[model samples]
Target: MTDTAVIELVEHAPAIGRPLPDAVGRALAASRIVDAAPDPYTAGQWVLRAGSKVGAVTLNVPDCAPVTVRIVPKVPIARLFFLLGYSLDSRGWRDEQVEVAEHRDLLPALAQAAERQIDRALRQGLLQGYRDAEETSLVVRGRIREAEQIRRHFGATLPVEIAYDEFTTDIPENRILRATVERLLRLPGVARDVRRRLLHQRARLADITPLVPGQALPEWHPTRLNSRYHQALHLARVVLTDSSPEHAAGALRIDGFLFNMNKLFEDFVTTALCEAYRGTDHSCRLQDPHHLDEARTIRMKPDFVLYGPDRCPHAVVDAKYKKEKPDGYPDADLYQMLAYCTALGLPEGHLVYAKGNAPHTAHQVRHAGTIIHQHALDLDQAPDGLLGEIRSLAHVIAADPPV
Candidate 1:
């Protein structure tokens, strides 16, 4: 698709009166970057509505101009990065340290920050770690797999199966960094300078093993030996986790980088709340699983479940990233929180939204003796202000006694 043929749409806003080529429409539908439907008000026109996902994606079909659709998130690009960085590594990421000053868009800013972090991580040279390997070898190095040796060789002594630990730079940490660099190189909107730096990073990782496409990523543990890689790996994990690279849409080929704001909000809220409880008697569990019914048939997971020193749940919270409606925050959210409170046997529950139509409110369910509080966080505020809100909420949660 030509660079000039770009179509921009805001998150949760429908692009109306703009007729899309049938192929492009199909491509968008397949890419899942947005919801595409025929506009009822305008004949022969299409309506493309973006949901929680926000990023730039290019949808292509044969014999048509490729249409690059950019979905801008409701939150500012810098603030979105803060949410992402903090969620990925709460203690390491600082809003002022991210440095998205040069790039106003999400993709560029992310690419830049990722490249910088990766470069810093490699300044001291690639980290080396021990990796377990099992292979057929001419000679045993660590230990011989006698069972495998006999099964494959039928008692032949020429070759043997062996298991060993090899110390190498091609460990999970390097592989994750390499995969993230490769992912950034393939997508659009990366700055030319950033692309050069990413290429250099790739070269530094050239000897490392590339991650397999359909296989689970190799796991890495945090230790003092690889402490320098913590920040870079956190950013790399964020890039690798929240993106869709190449996927087919019938004849069209789609490539895009997207992030789900819903998940980002949830992760940030839950993680920051946990941080708030640090050094305190209370502990916070993220995505705490519990059954809603005594039969243990219906499972429920609350975003944040605060437990007291007695090891009992004191409060539960759910994070919601949504568009403000005309009347108020949806009642369905209140219902869900109520269910969590009832299931957790807590006196009250909380619902936090990115923004809300009305001020903070609470609902008391009659006869149930359960209260559900709805709180709206102003994400548009500075990071300090936003985090202050979380601290305030944490205090409120601690102040309430469990019934």
Candidate 2:
């Protein structure tokens, strides 16, 4: 629980339960991530283990991360944010970047990102505090609801939908972000002293979640000063999606916070490779697949399929966050890559593992008529270095197979 670490949740990994101070333990009880587990000690605290789902999370509080009874995990939120932020930027999420805190983890990191916007929002005057929109209703009216109510509600204005001009902070976007901040503030690890301040500041915002992303965002004029609000709203919307909200009996409960590095790595490599191959004779397609059977029920999806001069799959590449040992690679991965090669009518496929462990090597599966290349990319390398690995990877995937 050092200042700089976040919790890393490995898929199906076990964590051990440990003792905690009574206050800390009681506070943790409110969290859905940590739970009671079989323990040898009479004190009988709890353990946080990785769930069946694979993901990572940065915590604003200590002793969270909801792992198995035997695990003590620390994730590097700063590193992950840098990688994702880069990918997001390339995908057109541009902004004045937020600084990564030296001592805090993910949720706080998120809070920090939003805090700047929140401050700007306060200065600009609560976005929901501005002008009120006009509306119409039967009883209290800008216009008549008689015909509309007659057609829809049998002409009853008593139980009627009223359209009126009212100043309200209950709008969808504002509600979502406000709720997120309130939820974060209530979590265990958030600094206790900041809670009162944040609550008072956010008092103008009613914590609610009636609106989410797929609904259209409130449009803002593309002017210079309006940038902060837009960026704030965008960050709010993005964070809201990852942190799904649950409400029960007047309390907001969150399913533990986690980010899946597997998907992140897959996307980064796939997208970066595509960018590298831009303007080249060959085209790079990600998650493109061919059917494994005539029925099309089964699919052999490869992360990246590099096309060559013939307009066919020159090579199939798949990314792996957690890889097997070099001596004995995972059979499932072997089977998968082999299928990708066979279905795509290619002779070889490449599996990219994240940890910078083994040297790049190749193996041929028995009677499969295809060879599998295991390439390791060191995620600890600089972002540019990471991209360089993808660039070199392109040569291997796009080049001719060793006959």
TM-scores, all candidates, are 0.92, 0.66
Candidate 2 residue-wise lDDT, 153-266, digit = tens: 785655555555555555544665575566456544445544665676577564433445345544434345445455566566555554332233223223334445567677
Tens-digit lDDT string for candidate 1 (80-165)? 98998888888977777678855657788888888988998899999988889999988879999889989999999878899999
Q: lDDT of all the models against the reference?
A: 0.83, 0.58
Angstrom error of the Cα, residue 109, model 1: value is 1.0
- Measured by TM-score, how close is model 1 to the native structure? 0.92
